[model samples]
Target chain A: MRGADILRFSVHALKGYPVRSVLMLVAMAIGVAAVVLLTALGEGARRYVTGQFASLGSHLLIILPGRSETTGAHPPILGETPRDLTLDDAFALLRSARIRRVAPVALGSAPASWGRRERETTVIGSTADFQRIRHLKLAQGRFLPEIDPRKAAAVCVLGAAVRAELFGPEAALGRWVRLGDRRFRVVGVLAPQGQSIGLDLDEVAIVPVASAQALFDSPSLFRVLAEARSREDLSRAAADSRDIIRDRHEGEEDVTVITQDAVIATLDRIFGALTLTVAGIAGVSLVVAGILIMNVMLVAISERREEIGLLKALGAASGKIQLLFLAEAGLLSLTGALLGLGLGLLGVWAGRELYPALSLAPPAWATAGALAVGVGAGVLFGVLPARRAARLDPVQALSGR
Target chain B: MIRLQAIQRKFVVGDQTVYALNGVSLEVEHGEYLSIMGPSGSGKSTLLNIIGLLDHPTSGQYWLAGKDVTGLADEERAEIRREKIGFVFQLFHLVARLTAAGNVELPLTLAGLPRPEREERVRELLAAYGLTARARHLPGQLSGGERQRVAIARATVTRPEILLADEPTGNLDRSSGREIIELLESLNRQGLTLLLVTHDPQLGRRAARQVQMRDGRISGDGRGG
Candidate 1:
């Protein structure tokens, strides 16, 4: 039979059994939709986290006081190093022409109180360059000044949540708040930044690095944030920071200097694998849907045996009959796949409306893969039924056996 | 033309080899109008099925239009069945899902006739069957006589050289059965070879030639009145 005729007749046969056709269609659609929606969710999470990391800073290197690379020995817990990464080591990194500026980081929790309101908040210490490189904008007042490394400036910056808790309705600039045993005047109130790279910036206090060292009674710094002068200077800045730390700490390379892109790339690799794993799990449903297609097709062949016989008696060859049934199966799959794509897109659209921060969109490859698998499964599972229909004895079929 | 030489069709009914056609030999010429009549289990339908290439004889040689069809492959047999033969059944066997016109167009569509030609052929055939007004009705909606007419129209739509009908009027009322018989006779008169299988003696005698079968063998072959 001609291709068009085969398709037309198969369509007629599917329409003849409305309930069965609809049931089969739903099975295939749900499978395809599961694959699409799940992949969208997985891919969306990867993009959200990777984007957060990318927005941390440009041409940046974060230096921490520990060796991240293993040396075939027992690793230290709580970042124990041979020597402390001091303020002098952080400033010495500026000697490299590739490095633009460095911000020494020291953090500890302390109670800040004003007029009976008190809350224990994380206290981050850095210099004037901290606000610029960390991208922290101020709602009021000014950041800390560029003072000598040993001199403790009795000034502090309040995070948005801390300001609300301590000075509620009252303006906080210049207000003195006690931390541990000493007091520091509030210099600025940071604008609200809800969350960035897993850190809650809205609930911390920023102070001069010297003050944080004295308030916490610790000499070792937590980290050093270094800025590279240009994109090409990034790798050189990291190497320069590592060399500076090694030179200052008894010639021991104790600190880990990590470029911003390396961190983002590591995170990207982890999340990319996670996305594929979830996509694979979702593909199982497509296999089940393929089996459903096979079952329904077998039943359809049995129900339409007389019709098959009639076509054979009308001079249709076995191959032609098989083509007719396979066309039916293929049509069912194509339509179901398209419907599933629309359903998944609609689901992602709804997800975006619910959580706009997460960019929930299916990747192009995911969409194409889902469609290809859906149709391919339907056709593959359809082969057995089509062959059975083709091999039916016309005489037996016509006799209604 | 059709020829069967000692065609033997055997069936294994629970380990017993039953000869459906013990040793049936028949020759039919083009445009001949004949009927094969017999009691039940006498293999009249089996013989017709063999001649129509619907079944292969177990141990025999058969020829159709100068081709050695007995040993031909299934594809070749299907080609002969599709191009040179048509069948009308006792139950009419019209596809219930299709309209009258669609049923009539089945053979032409299988033959790969273009849409325009298929539509034209179906329309003319329905008109000749006095069914143009009922072209859009499904088999379920048509009367028994109309359904049989639709079947006849479908059977001849490919312009096959031979028509094999098995108990064509077995399921119809007397008036509708008579109408169907006249329709088949008219097609036979138009130079299409017609082979009818029937248990009704009156219907069996209406053909110009008749063959009587008993125990899977032809007992009588004679020109009818």
Candidate 2:
């Protein structure tokens, strides 16, 4: 038979039983849509995390006081007790050619009181370079003065929320605020930067690292944030930080230096696997839909036995008979895949609208894979019934026995 | 133009081998209007199915147009059936979903005839069958006589040399049955070989030659009234 004629005959057969055809179409369509939508969600989460990490800083490295074996999980619990990373270690890292800036960090929770108002807040201690290295924007006055790293300068910068709480609408720059029995003059108020990397930047206070260590009564630095001179120098800067910190700590290699790219790449791999797993789970539905097609096609073959017998009696080859049934399946799956694409896209649109922060888009591979699998399932599952139809005894079929 | 020799067909029914056709030999000339009549289980329909290539005889040498086709492959037999034979059934066997014109176009379409020629042939056949007005109507929408006419049109649309009909008028009323018989006779008069299978003796006698079958064997073969 001509290809067009075969297609026409198959279409006619499907149309003859509209409800059954639609049922098969819907089954296949739902299967494909499930794959597409679930993968979109998985990929969307990956993009959201990557974007969050990207917002942390570019070409950045963090030096923590403990050695962490893994890339992006909790620090290892059972290891050699890590030595303290101090101001001397941060100073030594600045000598490396690849290291552009280093911000020695110390953290504590302390209460800040100005006149009658007092609020307990997280206090981050670093040098003036903290503003530049951490991408903090200044709203008024200026950031901490570029002074000696060892000097405990009694100066501070207030986050936007802290400024509002301490001074209300007043100009609070250069005002003294007491933190843990010490008084510090605020030199700057930070512009409102929202939450990033788990820190609500608008709700904390920034002080010099030396003063924060004195207030917290600890000699060890919490972390050292370093920026590379260029994007290509990130790995070199991390290596230099690790080597310099090890040298400062008597060659113990006690600190873990992690690059921003390493963390992001790890996250990417983890989420990529997650996306594949989700798509695989959704693939089960496609197989189920294929089985449905097989069942329906078998019933269809039996119901139309007399028609098939008539066609055979009119000289249709067995292969032609098989082709007719296969064509029916192919048509159903093709249409269903197309419908699923549209439905999946609609679902993606709805998801984006519901959660504006999520970066949701169907991955190209997922879409293509879903469509390929849908049609493949149709053809593969179609084989048994088509073969049965081809093998039917025309005499028995014609007799309707 | 057709010959059958010692055709035998057997069925295993619950450990009992039932002979559907046994040592049946017959020769049919070109343009002959032949009818095979018998009671139920007499193998008249079985013989017709074998002649139409819808079934295979257990052991037989069948010749069509001087070609020994008994051992031909399935596809080869289908090719011959496509080019040399057509079928009409008691139920009219019109595909329920297709319109009258579409039904008539099926054989030509299966033969891979181009669209224009197929459309032309379908139009001519529908008009000849007096189904022009109902050309777009589905089989369910047509009456008994109309459906039979559509079936006849479909059978002849491919211009096959032989028309094998199994109980073509078995389901029709008396007037519709007469109409169908006249239509089959007209095709036979046009030199298309006709083979009709029926149990009605009156219908069997209308043919030019009649073969009466009983117990899987041909009991009588002679000229009909």
- How many steric overlaps are in each model, in order? 0, 0
Highest-scoring model, DockQ: 2
**Candidate 2 residues A1-401, lDDT tens each?**
88988888988899899999999999999999999999999999999888888876877888887876566653445457788788988888989999888999998899999999999988998998888888889899899889887889999999999999999988898799998789999999999987766678888888888889999999888788889998899988888887887778788888788789988999899999999999999988888888999999999999999888888877899999999999999999989888988999899999999987886887999999999999999989999999999989887887787
RMSD per candidate (Å) reads 2.4, 2.3
What are the clashing pairs of model 1?
A: none
Model 1 spans > 4 angstroms off: A70-83, A180-182
Per-residue lDDT value at A363 in model 2: 91
| Residue-level error in angstroms, candidate 1, position B91 | 2.0
Q: Write down the lDDT of every candidate, Cα atoms only.
A: 0.87, 0.89
Quote each prediction's TM-score.
0.95, 0.94
Candidate 2 TM-score, C-alpha based: 0.94
lDDT of 1 by residue, B1-225 (tens): 888899899999897989989888889999999999999999999999999998989988899988889987777778888899999999888899899999999888888989999999999989988999999999999999999999999999988999999999999999999999999999999999999999988889988899999988899999974
Would you list the clashing residue pairs of candidate 2? none
